[model samples]
Target: MDLSLSTRTEGERTVVVVGGEIDVYTAPKLREQLIDLVSSGQYHLVVDMEGVEFLDSTGLGVLVGGLKRVRAHEGSLRLVCTQERILKIFRITGLTKVFPIHASVEEAVAATD
Candidate 1:
């Protein structure tokens, strides 16, 4: 499954809409996008993962990296993961407690406020 990523502004926050599988091969794309966003001073991010089908350890790592990147700059990184499979992965890995997971992009974007 190929990964597709699109980013846009939602008020003051940036929303990254992701689709398809997020494995080792596709995780780098996500990582680079996050890096680009953070590097350019766009720290408030909402990763809308509802369209994501499969997520692996590498994907989780990228999310964690993004979280750290934003936190280091006193910025915020939130996730919109309504899928049970993806939510389960975060819960099992104890990441649900680390990342702010929301039901929708609007909610996630509002959370930064």
Candidate 2:
């Protein structure tokens, strides 16, 4: 399936609502969006993945890259994903330690410090 990405502001965070599948073909779209957001000076990001139907290693890499981009500006990249299937990828890759995953956008946004 195709990927869908939308961005909005909540408090001090820019919430990127992601839906559909994130595979090799679609991961780059996400990566570009993240880069644009960060380059535009919006660093505190909360990626809401509740609508994600599937995720692959490329998607994980994009997330990690985004995290790094934000961190370079002393910013943060948080995730909102409660899907067990998608969460398993992070767990398996030990990214659970690298990123803060939240159950909801509200929780993720509030988690920004």
Candidate 3:
């Protein structure tokens, strides 16, 4: 699983662009990175997943976990998922209700406001 993260700060929000497969092996790394960002007091997080090719339960867990953490801090988390397969996972797991899904990174970032 290859992962690359790029962060763009806008106001009080931070959009983290994620590119690569998000699986059990790589989910922890993503979780850690997100946790670090949240702990740093950057609560509004947008995960850009346009480049992600795969995701498993671990990846979903990471996103859910981050959502919980952000909510606890009175912050928010949004996702940009365009892949049908990945979108299906969220739908099947009923996570579509838990997260605000965006068509693109720009939309996700704008939603943070």
Best candidate (score: lDDT):
2
**What global local distance difference test value does model 2 have?**
0.95
Candidates arranged by lDDT, highest first = 2, 1, 3
lDDT of 3 by residue, 1-113 (tens): 49777888966678888888889888888999899999999899989888888889899999999999999999999999889988999999999998999998777777734
Ranking by TM-score: 2, 1, 3
**Residue by residue across 1-113, what tens digits does model 1's lDDT show?**
79999999998899999999999999999999999999899989999999999999999999999999999988889999889988999999999999989999978877744
The Cα error of candidate 1 at residue 75, in Å, is 0.4
Error of 3 at 53 (Å): 0.7
Error of 3 at 86 (Å): 1.0
Worst 10 residues of 2 by lDDT: 104-113
- What residue runs in model 2 are displaced by over 4 Å at the alpha carbon? none
* Candidate 2 local Cα displacement, residue 31, angstroms: 0.4
List candidate 3 segments past 4 Å from native: none
* Number of backbone clashes in candidate 3: 0
Q: Rate residue 25 of model 1 by lDDT.
A: 92
- In every candidate, how many clashes are there? 0, 0, 0
Model 2: per-residue Cα lDDT over 6-106, one tens digit each: 99999889999999999999999999999999999999999999999999999999999999999999999999998999999999999999999999988
Which one wins on TM-score? 2
